[model samples]
Each structure stands twice: as structure tokens, then as C-alpha cells.
Target chain A: MTLRGKAAIVSYGETPVTRARKDKGEPRLSYWEYFAWATSLALKKAGMTTKDLDGQGLAVMHPEVDHSLFLGVEVAEMLGVTSKWIITPSHGGASGCVGLAQAALAVSSGIVDRVLCVIGDAPMTYGDTMMLTEHRRDFEKPFGVMGPTSLFALVMRRHMEQYGTKVEHTGKIAVTQREHAVLNPDAVFKERFTMEDYLNSRMIAEPIRLLDTVMRVNGGSAFIVTKTEEAKRWTDKPVYLLGYGECNNYHHGSKALSDATLMGIGQASREALSMAGLEPRDMNFFQPYDDFTIAVLMQIEAAGFCEVGKGGKFIEETDLSYRGSIPLNTGGGQISAGQPGLAGGNLNLVEGVRQLRGEGEGRQIQGAKAGMVTGIGAVQYGRNVGYNSVAVLGSEL
Target chain B: MSRFGVKEGGEARKPLPYITNYSQGFWEGTKAGELRIQKCNACSHKQWIPKAACEECGSIDLSWIKSGGKGKVYSYSIIRHVVMNSMAFEKEIPYALALIDLDDGVRVVGQVVECKPEDVKIGMEVEAFFEDIGGASIFKFRPRR
Candidate 1:
């Protein structure tokens, strides 16, 4: 289905990313605590209470412990609403986008007029390092390949070999992202970073410097999806979903990931532009996932927003600072901004919505009529998880 | 069995349960300090980071195949720092990370150790050496024998 002229993001909400090692006087703040905080904030921002929710969608990883908890059902009972739809989706790191995409379809299809999508946790629980080892095959885990940093380092090794891209080139991305973070009041890392700071940072994985990797965070984030008519009922400004696409290629740590040029985002971006009847030049901002600095380079290139391997050049030559040139990752991204897993993913979407609605407090992208948000999933620290999802969002229905 | 128990035949080696599923073969090879990969019997495709299924054809027919354990370095990085504590690395910053293309058509990324980080180069011949870290033999690439 074209899914054109259908659904819009009426309200976006999130608890500012925080590091809660332990839930304030609660049991370890399991996934449920984070989910509740995020969902409640989103509903409040939409000018609704949990009681106003008509439907719900649960997005998360860890099917073993997380899936059957019936979070959507739990929320419905809390609100005393007869939910018309309840969904639980597992898409690894891209779970938040998966939830939003599902919410758009639910609203557009009239399955639900409004839906809640959320995720978050304490980083120490399932940080990137543990996920790599815990989810890894026992055979491979023993080789001491215990983290994504080394796995990504593996991929960076090949890219630098093939493209002659220097570590300094990748360092520029960290330096610039930190600069943007300085302007973000809510960003976890507001410290100013010079290229020297990036260069001097310790190495976590070969090509992935300490600054290049995103730190774990404890927090929650959420989004509320509703129909265009319903969005008008709740708020005047509604960010519409224009286009989306997803692809998977799970090579693990074996081969050089195809489309390493970071052009995969373009695949979904193309579909979005086609759906919205728009073009790259028409976009006012871009929010490519910044789990790792190199991943951003790959995503922007994949989105065709810039040339192949020229992501470094684009960030270096142009002023991506607020109101300088085109604004990219104005939220400071997962790199400089805190990445609370699912919450971090929603942070990008929330920033896109905030900018589109002109509510961004200080780091607003000026004249932002339309925006694009993309997510990369399943990539171990260095290897491609071989999955990509992109969404094009706009101010009009 | 305990990971600390020493093996009878090998050089005071302990009984470490190799990683199962796709990586069991890889870990077993490292214990012997010899690198190997699973080759798809159906498609003749060479695999690294061993998997139970073939990546190209999705076939389950696979066999443990030994590698020449020698390859050309495709690319490399000089590590200037270490975030996690390390006893193996004596230096402060500079280290080499290289992508080595095995003769079997499989390439893997690993640290190029036992030499000055600056001495590493692309296209240089290198071989695999097993480094014992915390009772487990980890794979690291080095200059050719």
C-alpha cells in the first residue's frame, strides 16, 4: 500500500535521558519501569492521559524476558480503555523505529486512532558489550570478541583499506557531534571536543576510538501516532509519515558488509521521497543513527544525502551547527547525546518531530519544513547486522 | 568441566568449553592455536566466523576445513590507546588492526601484535597466532613466519 495522505505524529514525548543505575527505590528498574516512564511522558505531551489511549504497541528486544510481559495490555488496563489493538515487535536495535512504523500503519489503517510506542533501560543491564557476548554463539564468544567495538573495528579496517579513509576522517564526526551536544541542554555529553580530543581519546576498538563509540545510558523515550484528522483534534502541528523501507543482510563478522558506502539509508529515503513526492534538497534536516560515528558516515551516504565516503567531507566542509547549513542530528545523536537503547532511537524521532513543530528549545533547525530519520539494526560493534530502516517525516498530512 | 582444569595431551591446556552453534569450530581451532573455518559443502563457499548455515545458499551442509593460516593484510589501523584494561598490550596508544585475506577466500579482522604498531602495512604477509588471555586462546594476526 502507498500509505499516502494517512497518518501523522500528533505528539512526541520523552523523559530527558538520565543515568538511573537503580530505579528510584524500585527493583533494578527492569524494562517495565523505563517503558512506563516513557509511555506516560508521551501521553502527557499529547495532552492525553493513559486513559485516553485507544491502542498500544510494544517495541523491544529480549523476547525471552520482555516479549510476553504484555506491556501494551498492561497499559490498556491501567487506563481503563478497551484497546482496539495491541502489538509487540522485536527488531533488535531498530525496535523503536519498528514500533513507530507499526504505529503509523495501525493509525493509517484505522486499527487504532492513537498508539503508544516506547523502550529504555539502565545501560549496565544489557550494554553493547554484554549484548555482543550474551547474544553471540558460544564458539565465537571464546575468541575474546566480547564487544561490538572490536566487531566494528573489524569493518572499519576493511573500509579504510578499500577507501583509504583515515582515522582522522572518522574523528571529524565525533568532534562535530560533540560540538552540537554542547548546545543541547539535555545531551549527556556537553563537553567541548577538539579534533585533538578525539585523536587523543583511548581506543576501544581499533578504528573505533573511545569517542567514536556511544556510551550506555539509563532512560526512556516515546512517540504517539495518530491519524491526520485525529492529530488535528489533539494538536495543530502534526508530522506526517511520508515514506519508509527496510532490508536485512546478516553476514555477521565474516564478509565485508555490502553497501558499506553507507548508501543503504538512500534505499528507504528514496521510497519516502517517492511517497511524499519530495527530494533530498527539499529536506531541512537529517537524523541518521549515530550509535557509532562511522555508522553515521555510512547512513548519510546510504541515504544519498551526501556522496559515498564523502560523509566526512560533508560534516567537515559544511557548518552543520544549528542554523549554519542543513542541520543533521541536532539532538547531538547517540554519540554525544545519551543512547538509552530504544529510548535513544526515539530521541532522534522526537527531535525530528520537535524541529518540524518548531518546539525545539535551543538547537532548533531553522525553517525545518520536513525531516528524515533513519535507523541501522543488528550491526555488531564492527559487522553489519545487515538491516536498515528509514522514515521520511513532514509537517503536512 | 571447569575451565581451569588442565588437559592431558596438550601443553598444560585446560578444558575450556568451546563456544557452541556457529562458532564452536572457530574456538576449537583456537585452542589448538590453528585457525579454521566452515566451508559450505553445497556451494563450495568458504566461511569465516563459522556459521551452521551457508551465507550464500543458506544450506546446512558444512565441514570443518583448515586454513593455510597465512594471508595478505588488506588494511590496518594503529591503536593509540586502550579503554578496557589489558595485560597483553604493554604500550600506551599505538596498535595495529588489520583485515587479512586468507588463501581460502575468507578474510577476518584482528589485532596485528608482536611488532611495533608502525611496522604494520597493507598487503603485508601475516599469519595467525593464538594469544592466551584469561585462560582462553584469542586470535591475533602477526607478521608471516
Candidate 2:
């Protein structure tokens, strides 16, 4: 069931990430408008046009907003492209990667020849995040659970309790990613921060600090995928889709109980690696979906890059910069790059493709081949770890 | 009732819990000062989030049972800031919110009362106690004697 070498990412497009731009009162482009704009950019880079795309895909985490519902059906009306196969995933942060997986399956199954997967949102400009947290009000919010920082603070505390992980460990990730952000032209937070700054930063929740959180920005990213043969003909340096795995509402036991410190990536990554015939050690780079610093640590351990409870030591010893071993979040993960609503997952996925194509330009990982990109969905809930998805990609089949 | 937020006339206004038809019995049990959860009749699985059908066995045969209200802290987070998200908990800054693994093999989250955030431990034994808040019986945990 592996989608190996079936679909390949030939081109990618990204909009500049920004917060409330005072000069422009509010964003002029709607969500689908951003999609059309980014899609045009992707098509231009690929030397292709909308007529070449028979498949269309997008990610919408919450349909709480009216425009979000039936978004897939509206793509043709918005982009004016005829879509024979359409996919719209509702996996929250995981939606982008999950949509990629579904598109790959549809393309491989001969349902569609060329699929363009685009993810974009303007929560900063158009929507209120408080409206999206409605489901939590009934069960989790009744307690003192304020938001994500508060919930992840619980995970960090448990990790510290169980593994003795320290703030200094998470500081390394924050500091390094900000350094990467400095080189990223599109990153919102381009200022370099230090361990001292991360440590002394204001605590949002007791254990989670301001530096551990990601700021929302208005942005979009799109990637064009076609048959592997066509992609190779376009460029010998095509980024092949090797494997994809997704697990939702994953918890242990018939009771659905889970260790708050662990994510479902253990099983998800295993399935991905098994399909790709690759191991955790074989991954040339890591571009994991990082809404919080604690999440990156959890994903690192759960994906078996390091043993459980040893994420602290592994990160301490590894150089995560682009030039170093196992380059992580080289394009500045969502933590430092400014998360662009549901497009955050594709940000990492697109980065993995970019690095494999040797297009990292400023902070390139030398000789990068195979890499892993991960996603986490709806993490603040008390027990259930929402959707966990992994996409394995490489320069070679 | 504990203060949620202050109104103009020296009165408090707080966001109250929404009791649904599926969870009406659970809230009723809380009102009666009992920690109640649904236990599946077919598979004997206990769940904190009550529903119409059993999650494991798919049996609609469910019954509400009172738990012993005893558990150990599985994890906890100290809330040093609350006004940023909810103005109702503005006065309750620096409170400890804990995930408890109850003796009845279920997990629940609640605020740890009668103790400082510094006093909370990972494996501390705690017992559930009810408090009237926003016209609802919400449970709070305290260090057991």
C-alpha cells in the first residue's frame, strides 16, 4: 500500500508571513483568494497552468466559520479549475499533511494525474480563535484549562517529572529555531534570541513561557504534485512521496487512556518508516509540526530519533542548525516562523520538499535526501491526542 | 459560590458549564456530592466523558456509578496567568490544575484546592470535593488526609 514514487512534489509557493500590518487596515484577500494566489505562484514555478491540474485538495480544520464548510466544493468556483478528484481534510494541524497523503493516494490510484494541494488561512485577519475553542467549553474548559499553553504546560511538567527534562533543554530548540528564522526571508520572527532570553521570558503558563508559544500570522503555502514520471521529466531533482501515515484519536487501552507526555507518533512513524523501508536514523532531516517546544521534544522521542525520556540528552548533543547533523526546522518551525492557521503543517511539509530539492538557499542542508515531516492536531484536549500524521519524502525513489 | 467575575452591582458573573442530555446524570450526581462516571455494562469499561453508547463494546447499555473520589496526580500544570484567556479566572491566578488517575481506573482533570502550586506533586494522593460555582457543582481536588 506504499505510495512510493507514485506522486512527486514539483513546485511549492509560500506567501510572506505577517501579523496585523498597521499600514493595511485588514487583509484584503479571503482564505480562498490566498489559495488562488498561491496556486498561481506554484504553477508559474512549475511551468504549468491550472488546466494541467485535474485534482484539487485543501485543508480546513474547523468549519465553525460559514465559509469553511463545503470549502472543497467551492475551490472550483474560487480558482475556476475543473477538479475531477477533490479532497478536503478536517484534521486540524494535521490536515495539510493528511491532505497530501490523500492526494498521493488518489494520484497513485489513477483517479487523477495532477493534484495541487494548497493550505491557507487568515485567522489573524479574518477570524477569532476563541470561536474555534467552542468544543472545549463543555468538558475541558470547565476546569482551569485556559488554552494550549496551559495544557502543554501539563505535558512539560510530566516530562520533567518522568525524565528530568529541563527548561534549558527546551531553550536550545527555541534559540536555534530563532537563529534559523533570522535567515528565513518569510519568517515573521526574524530576530535572533538567546538561551538567557528564552529562560527569562515571561511565563504564559507556569512551566510554558512566551518563547514556547507560536504566534498566529496571515499566510499561505501550496505545492503541486503530479505523477512521478512527469515530475522527473520536469526536473531530475523531484521530491518523491515515499510514505505517509496518519492515526487519529489514538490512545492506549480499551479505555482510551494515554500518557500525557507521549504522542501517537510512535505508531504513526513506525507505519511510515515501515512503508518507506527507512528507519528513524535514516531520516536526513526533521521538519516536524511544532506548535509548542514541548511538542517537538515529544515528537522527537515518540518518532524514535531518541529513546523515550532521553529527548533532553539527544537535543542537547545534536546540532539542529542547517549545517549540523539531523537538521531540524531549518526553515524556522511554526514556533519561530509564525504559524499561518491550518497551513502550519504544510509549512513544514513544503520545507522538507524544499530542502530535498536543494532549494534551502540561505540555510541549506548539504546533500539532503530523505526527510520526515510530522503534524499534530487539537493537542490541548485532556486525554486524547488528536490526529498524528507523518510524511516521508526523498530525492530518490 | 466562588467568584468568577465581578458585575457592576457587586455581583459575580461566571461562565457556567453546559449540561447536555447525555451528561445530565453526571451533573446531577455532582449536585448530590458524588463523583459519578459511566461504566459500560457489556465490557465493564469506565469513561469520564459520558456518551450514549459504549466506546469499546458499542453497547448502548450504560449505567452511572459513583466513584470513590480517590486518585493520584498523573500530571499537573500551574496556572500563573488566567486573565489572558478567561476573565472569570482572573482572581484565581497561580492555581494548580491536575490530571488525576482515579482509583476507579478513570482520569479526570480538576483544580487542586487547599494547597499552593508549589505544594503539588506528581504522585500526590488527592480526593475529590464538590464546590458550588456559577450555579453548578464543580469538583475540586485536595490533599487527602
Candidate 3:
């Protein structure tokens, strides 16, 4: 079903994501506290309050966090309104975008309007207990694959073997994002980097240098979705979701080719673009997943931004240094913005909304209109190829 | 230990178990000095990295076909460094990581033991040898013996 002219994201909000947490002295707020503040900010930005929310949803990685009751109940109770729908779509990073699609469906179908989607967490303090790792208690969690980093490292090695891409080429992508992040004060990494810094960094996994991986940060981001007509009452700049698509493949198998390439994202992006009546070239900006530099390259290539095996070349030609030719990660992405796992994709979505609204701070893309956001979740160590969710956001409203 | 190049009269290697899965049978056969792979009867799918069912089809009907364990190297990498807490790989620096394409159209990834890293090459014929790693028996490749 094409959301062709039906619904749009009127406003998006995120709390300041800095190294030192944002909290008042007396008693520091918990992760949930930050989530509540961010959710309120998003609703307020859209010229509404929790009072306008008739539906609530959460996208998170931890199942034990009681995410449903935590965010859903709190938002509902704060608004003093009972919600008919409570959605908690948990699938790692992709959960945020997936939850957005689900919420959009609810809004479009008249199940309820004004759905608030939230994903936030404090990984630094509780991620070990909160995260699902190879050493964790899950049945297939062992197998020596620690987290997304190690798993992606394995895939990077395989891709290198097949495509003959040099490790230095992969470093270029990371270095470029670092350069972009340097310009974004809200970004965790504010220092400029040379390509040499990336290449000289310690190798975490073969072909995956320290600069290639994302740091775990404590943060949360949120969005407010309502019908287009209702959204127009709130904000003039409404980024409409033209299309939504998602797909997955077997994640746990050892087949190097299947594990390394993200065929799922490619399939989803194709369907999403087709539904939106747009093409890859029509996108003004792209917020490809940057959990790792290679991941970004893989997604870019898979989405037809460039031919397979040419992602590195695409990066070099784009002049991705600080003020790039093709501006990417204007919000510093997960690489430099501190990846809060499930909250990472929400960060991307929030930034996409900001860009479409022409309000990205420090590194806003000039006159940005059409934007694409893709989320990659559940690295290949699990039961299936990572799930991918792609959304096309445009400034048509 | 001599199979992987320790001094002629070197001390016995550490205890290890060959990872026994559905593939355990083939590993056991190799311990008895034979190389075997599973061949699916329904779809004629020859598979390495053994499984209970054919990946192409859900058929559990498979037969263990003895292989010469000889094949061409499909790809390779040489590790020149080690990270912290890797004592088990202490003396194996500059080791070769290779993928071997069996004549039966299946490929397996493992280190090529008993050969210098520089000597490894794509399309070079190699055979398998069982190596013990932290009490786990792993299949490693070597220049055809």
C-alpha cells in the first residue's frame, strides 16, 4: 500500500547526544528519564503533546526492559489518555524503522492517529546485561561471535577476498564519516581525522580497523507520526513516507558470500523506491547504516547508489571530507554519534527528518528535499541474514 | 604434532575434540584416515560444512561420499599478527587462511597447515589434515601428501 498522499512525519526530536550525559545534578535521570524527555520534545516540536497521542510504540533490543510498559505506559499515563494500540517491535537496529512502518500503518488505517515511536537506552552502564552477545545465555549465542563488530569483520574479510578490495579502501569510508562528524558538534567525535589515522588505527578484526567500528553510547531518539491532515495543523514541513519495505535472509550460516552481502537491503530498497515512484538518483541525501564503514559501502552499493565493488570509488569521488560534495551523515551517524544499538536507527531517521526539514545544525545539506534511510539489524551470527528496513522521506508536504 | 611441523621427537600436542555435529561422522572417518562429504540423494547437492538436511532442499536423505580430500585453493590470507589472549596460536604467526574448492563443487575454509604462507596459491591442489586446537579437532589443509 503506497502512503502516496496519505501520511507524513510532521516533526522529529532527539535529546542532546554528547559524551557527558544530559542530566540535572540533584538526582541523575535514568535511561528511561532521557527517553521520556526526548519523547516529550518530539511531540512538542510537532505542536502536540502526549495528550494528542492515541497510540504508543517502542523499538528496542532488550526484551527484559519491559519496553512496552516502560515507554508505552509512561507516555500514555503522562498524556492522561489511554491508547488503543501498544506496539513493541524488537529486532535490534531495524526495530526503529520497523516500528515506524507499523505505526504508519496504524495511522493510515484509522486504527488511531498520532502514534509516538521511541527507542532509547543506556548501553554504557547496562548493555552487558541488556545486550544479547555470543557469550550471553541464549542457545545459539555462543559460537565465538561476540557482537556485530566481529560478525561484520568476518563478512568484511570475505568481501575483500571476493572483490579484491583493499583494506585501505574500506578505511577511506570510515575516515570520510569521521571528517563529517568533526563538523557536527552534537557528534561524539568532534576532531578531524586524516586517512592515515584510519589506516594506522589498530585492527580489531582482520581488515576492520578501530576507526571502522562504532562506539557504544547512551542515548535515545523519537518521532511523532500522525495523519497528513493532522500533521499539517502542527508543522508546515512534513516529511512524507512515500514507501516502506523490509526483508531478511538466513543469518547464522557460515556461507561467507551469503553472510557478507546484504541482499535483503537491496531487495527492500528496490521495492520501496518502486512504490514511491522514485529512483536511486532521485534521492537528495542518504543515511545508510554506518555501524561499520564497510557496512555503509555495502548498503550504498546494494541500494544501487553505485555498482557493486565500486563503493570505495564512490566515496573517494564524492569528496566526503568535512563539507562533502554529496553530504552524508550530517547528524554524525552512529559511527561518531555513539550507537545506542536499537536507538541508532532512530538517530538516522531523526536526522533524515531534520535534513528534509532543512534544519540540520552544523552540517546541514543545502536545500535538501528527498531523503532515504536504511536500517540494518541483527548481524549474521543470528538465525537469519540481518533484517533491513528502508524508508523514503520527501519534502512534498 | 609432526603433521604440523614440531621437532622430530617433539612433545605430544594438547588434547582436542573434532567438532562433532552431523559432520562429526565425516570427521571421525578422517581420524580413521579417510575424507568424506555428504551428497544429497534428492537434489544431487554435494555439500561441505556438513548438515542434517540439504540447504537447497529440506531433504534429510544424504550419503557420506568418500573424497580424496584433494582440491584447489580458492582463496587465502596470511596472518602476521595476533591480538591479546591468543596463546594457542603462539608459534603459528604468518599462517595461511585458505578456501579449498573440492572437485565435487563444494568449498571449505580453514588454515593450510604444514606449508609456508608464501607458498600458498589459488588453484593449487591441497589435502586435509586434522589438527587439534584447545581440545577441539579442526580440519586444516596442507599441500597434497
Q: How many residue pairs clash in each candidate?
A: 22, 0, 11
DockQ of each: 0.27, 0.59, 0.09
TM-score of 3: 0.77
**Tens digit of per-residue lDDT, candidate 1, span A226-255:** 777778888888888887776655333334
**Top-DockQ candidate index:** 2
- Please give, for residues B1-145, the per-residue lDDT of candidate 2 as tens digits: 4333566565444466678888889889889999998999899888877778987889999999999999999888888776433666777877999888889988888899899888999899999999877578878899999
What value does the lDDT take at residue A9 in candidate 2? 87
Q: Provide the global lDDT of candidate 1 against the true structure.
A: 0.67
Write candidate 2's Cα lDDT for A1-397 as tens digits: 6787788988888887777576867554556666777778888888877767644443233321235566776776677676887777777788778877887887788877668888667766665552544447656676777777777888898899989999988999899888888988888888888899999999888788999989988777888777776786555678988887777777665354566776788888988888899998899999889989988888889888999899999999999889888888998899999998877878889889989998898988998989999988886355635889998999999
Docking class of 2: medium
Candidate 2, residue A184: lDDT? 86
Least well predicted 10-residue stretch by lDDT in candidate 2 chain A: A57-66
Better of 1 and 2 by TM-score: 2
lDDT of 3 by residue, B1-145 (tens): 4432243665433323335457567656666666677888998777765667886787999888877777877655555444322323436665666656776666666677787877887677998776444334456788986
Proportion of native contacts found in each model? 0.23, 0.59, 0.00
lDDT of each: 0.67, 0.80, 0.66
The order by descending TM-score is 2, 1, 3
| Fraction of true A-B contacts recovered by candidate 2 | 0.59
